[model samples]
Target: MRIGELARRSGVSERSLRYYETQGLLQSERTSGGHRHYAESAVDRVIRIQTLYAAGLNSKKIAKLLPCMRDADGRPNEIATPTLVNELTTERDRIDRMITDLLRSRDVLDEVIDTAADGATTDPASLARRR
Candidate 1:
């Protein structure tokens, strides 16, 4: 498919698709007129790239990690080494800490919300449900 098709199918903007190409997180071939073309698998690849980025992995880290993902044959890729494993482990731990912090923050926000609701809300049933 073409770049536009890929972008539409993947729900990504054309600019981001180009950026992903520049960052080496995506691949495309060039036509004789210099238009970009991608294989059908590029759709899945772009989604995978977006997922890794959403997980807080930088382009560099994602580039390394992408190849370590499972192959089409359902087997783990051989691209991961012990060093990469250690690095990914550290990243996972950092994400875990961030999750914990966010949960704590949400708890605090919930308490403030409950306190504010206690005064403004007259529906005891609704407030009880909230708590």
Candidate 2:
């Protein structure tokens, strides 16, 4: 397919696809007139690229990881080495911490909601008077 078709199918912008190609996260072939041509699997590749970006991975990291993804040909290749494994691990830990923090915030909000529902004024002055 062409770039526009790929962009439409993948729900990614044409500029983003071009940027991905420039960043080496995606590959394309040039036609006789120099127009870019992408394989059908390019749609899926774009989706994966968007997913990694949404996961907070940078373009460079996604470039390193993209090679591990197989093309339609099904050839096996390893993209990330041992060094990247450490980075991935660190990312995972950071994600875990963010999740924990979000849960804590949610708990606090829930408590506030419960207090309000029970008609409790949790103001410092009210609490002092109650004590």
lDDT for each residue of candidate 1 in 1-131, tens digit (9 for 90 to 100): 89999999999999999999899888899999999999998888899889888878899998889888986567877679898899899999999999999999999999999987776588787779878
Clashing pairs in 2: none
TM-score of each: 0.87, 0.78
Question: What is candidate 1's TM-score against the reference?
Answer: 0.87
For model 2, the run of ten residues with the poorest summed lDDT: 117-126
Query: After superposing candidate 2, which stretches have Cα over 4 Å from the reference?
Result: 70-75, 117-131
C-alpha lDDT (0 to 100) for residue 45 of candidate 1: 86
Candidate achieving the largest lDDT: 1
Q: Which lDDT tens digits does candidate 2 get at residues 1-131?
A: 88999989999999999999889888899999898999988988899889988878899988877787676678756756888888888888988898999999999999999987566565776678788
